[model samples]
Target: MSAVTVGQELASVPYDELIKNILLAMVAAQNEANASFIEGINDLVGTEVKIKYKEDSTEKEISGNALAFGILPTLLQIQSGIIEIKMAITLQQTREFQVGVKARMGFRVFSASVDAKYQNTYSYKVEGSSLVRIQVAPAPPPQPLMRAIEYIASKTAPTIP
Candidate 1:
């Protein structure tokens, strides 16, 4: 008896299709009952605080839709504070956006780098077929809310437990 090895296979998915699917899924998830849909993510990576979203309205919609989906995405806009640590596409199809550290405070730190553009072509394979994969960029690093809490804490003295 001879042992034969077969390579794994992948699925075929189009970039545009993938993006549309993700957007649809997001909408669907938000529409789902008792489903918590997060439109935005906030966190404290370091000294800098960052907020990201395709549009601020997305957050409002998420908040309003929270009742059905159980989660809402909020639009975050930090006027003065830290800089954006990471940039993600979240949903990419016709256009390509790089994910990385960008500006700080109000000043632009790094020049925008175009790793891939709308013309760029990329593909993925799954289940023995090419799967269209939309580049879902990582959410921006969350801003630290500890400072606000600390400020409040400092204002108020600790009481006995």
Candidate 2:
């Protein structure tokens, strides 16, 4: 006799929660960066820096800290993603039996011999794995957030006398 069996993972991953947590972590990091940048920009916001370049004959000066002009753009983007899994298993059982008899007779007496054999074997194996992957790229901030940042920057600009 023979038997075969297949098996897979017993526990499942909660993909929805994993994705949500990842996105939330990204947002939290961005918020932290924005807060740090705004705090540092406060010192440079009111200060003016002069730049002199002999383009033709006149010097040009730009009075703004670029960092204070806008919030940092989002650098990570959730693009294409993929998940894969593979599983393999095997099970086997075997039984065998043998019987033999022999007899020899001469003139007066007879003799007989008997022999028997039995064997059994069993085997099992299992293998499996899973993979998760995600592709990402740099991305600009959302339009609404960009607009708000622009408005805030414009209002905070220092007036030149």
TM-score of each prediction:
0.21, 0.35
Model 2 weakest lDDT span, ten residues long: 111-120
**Cα lDDT for residue 39, candidate 1:** 18
Using TM-score as the measure, which candidate wins? 2
Per-residue lDDT of candidate 1, residues 79-143 (tens digit): 23222211122221221243552323332211111123311322222222222333343334434
Regions of model 2 farther than 4 Å from truth: 1-13, 48-127, 142-161
Listed per candidate, the RMSD to the true structure in angstroms reads: 22.7, 22.4
Error in Å for residue 47 of model 1: 28
- Give a tens-digit lDDT track for model 2, residues 1-161: 21222211221223444455656766676677766655655555454454445656766555555434443444344443342223212122223231231212211111111111100111212222223344444356567755766775787663333
